[model samples]
Target: MTFDLIIALATACVAFVLSKRSVAHFPLWRAVVTPLASIIGSGFLLLGPILNIGYGGYAPLIMIALCFVAFLFGGVIRFNMAAGEQAIQNGDYGALAIRIETLSSWALAFAYIISVSYYLNLLGAFALSLTPFNSDLDAKLLTTGVFFIIVFVGWSRGFKSLEKMEYVSVSLKLAIIAGLLIGLMAHFGHRALDDALIFNPPKLDGWSALTLAFGLLITVQGFETSRYLGSEYDAQTRIKSMRLAQWLSTAIYLVYILLISYVFRPDQMSSSETGIINMMQIVAPILPFLLVAAALASQFSAAVADTSGSGGLFAQLSRNRITERQAYLLLAVIGVALTWSANIYAIVNYASRGFAIYYGLQAALGAVIAARQNTGWQRVGFYGLLATLGAVIALFGQPVE
Candidate 1:
């Protein structure tokens, strides 16, 4: 544990230095892709294991289903991206756009609250694991303080600052994930063939499977971060980057699930939120610290990015009546409240539902915009279909075990 703290603290110092250094301007890809740090953070570590915990050999099916819905969600965001750019460019957010933006902003803000809670819980778990003296309360308090500070600083400094640091955070996370995959493959060696063919029967019926798919929607929530990039980036770049992020995430998730599912029996992976840590611990003791550090870094980066996005949305929707700082302050307070009042899994449920609600609004707005632009019935029908799907998930998607 002492060694773990040393590694974590060293990692933190390196991150701090990276943040302080001058960063070059982002290219089109970098500009649009960096925000994905918010989406792909600790999620890469947790979501696959969570799916395995429930679906076992059937987890890949759920992953494919999730990828489909995520692409649909991406379509919803892409369709609406034009309207947002137009709103920014003309400084005339139409009545319908404003209404949609308002709804989406509020829903995303609530989702940010849940996300903050979940991030803090992950941080607390790490803190407790590393130190015998730290209680959950102590961990929460420490995390809450750090979270508020990051949100406030990021809001005051603006997206440009966040974008600058994003490359480091995103790279670190991706590297950690890649290293884990390599480590697992090396450890498995010839056992890979034996494990690859292992299968368990389906545990969920169709309705339950659908419910689980919707419930796991939070795993792809960050792709829509591109939706708000209009103020800083070109429309084409935003759309392209968003699609790239979605496809990239889908591929990464598929590989991650396959690798993890082979490592454990279906029943062996239960409902623990920290399944990644446990899995790593079983293979090699030193491995857990690396995963823990990655989780901490990823969660911190994600929380800051989302908090910044929510603050930007609130400031824009309010026409600057609420400054970004004030919006961030409000969000931080809400996040702190949610962190204290809710467990991590409950927060995950709320986060999933909140993003699902936002996706529904985006889909609805996409349909409306498609109608206005006379983009043809084909486009309209596609957007409408997505809207119906989002609405179904928003209204009836319950938390799945």
Candidate 2:
């Protein structure tokens, strides 16, 4: 799992740097890159096991279909950045921010609060998973202390530091996961393959596949971070990075799902929070420990990236006059209020819904751009947006419920 993402992420970084081009417009590359940090955490761990088991047999076919959905997600990254820039060019950044808040509503704030808390839990899970070569309460307390320490450091560090931190943590998690998977495969050998090939396929047909696709949609839905990074890059670079990284991530995820499916019975996988770790346990119990370590790395990197990006966005929004320091202060107060009361499961579920809506909003922007013929690949983009909206609505349902 660690090394599994290396090839794709390393490629994304290269593409990110290379995509830079001179343009007098809003920066998007950073925003696009930052979204990756958000997606690679809890969602990645939970999404595959649950969606695959619930909707389809552990088959490569669904993985392939899911890749298309992720591609549409990438289009969303492009749409958000493009639209935000257009709003600025029209001298309406404040209006754009209003539109954003209007679209996201209270659910957006609630979802983020849940996300922050869950990430903290993930940080605790990471340390606990690694705690036994065995220690006791002191060790646990120390780990808890470390989690708070990371949050402070992440919030305080500037963008350069945050990006570097994410790259390192992301790299470490990928390495650890890759090693564990390889180690497990070697130990398990080929015996499981014959049984896996015997394949008790899913019985569902037609529209159910679409619903499954929607569920799978949650897994591979990062790649919007580059848009956040746009201020640091040129326009051509932003667009290219957004497009290439999304497609690349889709391809990588498809391969991962396929290989993992081939290795085990998808139905045998648990849907509990520890599902990914449990799936690895089936391969090798020790793999769970390694995954937990990776999970720690996952949350650390993602939180740093997300918080920093959000802060920058505020600065951008304020610089553009959408909100003031009071808005920022109020948001912080709201976050603290929601903190201790958050239920991990419900928050994560609500987060997925919020993400779907956010992505759906971006898709709407893509459709508008497509209709106007403003960018390369507009027609595909138009359809991509629709597919994403369909998936979001069809799979996760509405936040109002």
Candidate 3:
């Protein structure tokens, strides 16, 4: 009870600070919040158990590798924000660059469709997890309902009202997350003093491990949200905000994984989607409640953000031939189909591949623009390699078994 009180107080304090006028009104913080919210969204809830179960003691190392790869891809997006935007505005870009950027935008739209399904499905799972009706079919039905709700609200009243929920949801999620970290740290320290920490060996080796890591890219995939905010923010602000968001999320993820990796034996971890909830039950009685709240807020906010983004991209790409309402309807239809057709793990893999293809195209576009500007071959070559890596992830990333 004392620990729970401490956790609750910490969470409340963080929430209060984040809600302050000074912090909320800061321009860079506002810019940082959008991408930061997306980057840490549903992924934070899922990664702990998945990483520990899959990689065992090596989970923290794998987390670092994922963050590093995401950082590199973020660099590619940042480069395009500065160079690609200017070139397109001045007609300084070539036909191929234009085509690649267009294709990448399409890829991103499709990825958003899959990701919305992913987010809502997780939301449904978590929503039901603490109840008596926590079954797979029940979860999917709930997800389908939420999809309809989002589409209805979006088509009827517009997302203007719903969009206002982003700030509150993000603040709540971050506060709960800070509390989670505190609980995990205290648990970890207790085990350390007792010499109870376990360092289990990796469960899968070499090729299988590599493919699994690739499949998990969607966990770190949301930083590119900054690249597409060109309409709202200037290039420099978007670039800097993206870098800051990535850095903040990376730090959060690494610490969470490190504290979590050695705290439990491999045999105790659950492989189910809501495994983190059960794992946190062992950390603190209050943690499961806090985690579920964070999961719901983060997932709904992320789904709404991506749905809004996908609809706008569809309308923009169609040159306004397709209205945003029509796009929302289409996204709802596709998202419902995805919710019924495959499990969450399969959706995660599909989303990862979709984003990888988009990243690959963006990297290729970056390389082309660099070459056109007579930039050194070394920079172009690095972008080419990054493009190839993205392609590899798209082609080879596999679903968790």
Best by TM-score: 3
Which has the better TM-score: candidate 1, or candidate 2?
1
Residue by residue across 208-234, what tens digits does model 1's lDDT show? Answer: 767767777777678888777767778
For model 2, the superposed segments whose C-alpha errors exceed 4 Å read 1-35, 56-59, 79-88, 91-114, 129-151, 181-189, 192-198, 201-216, 265-268, 318-339, 372-401
The digit string of per-residue lDDT tens for model 2 on 125-160 reads 445544563333433354345445644554465567
lDDT of each: 0.71, 0.54, 0.89
Quick one: best lDDT, which candidate?
3
| lDDT for each residue of candidate 3 in 22-86, tens digit (9 for 90 to 100) | 99988888888778877888778888888888888999999999999999999988888888575
Clashing pairs in 3: none
Error of 2 at 124 (Å): 3.0
Stretch of 10 with least lDDT, candidate 1: 17-26
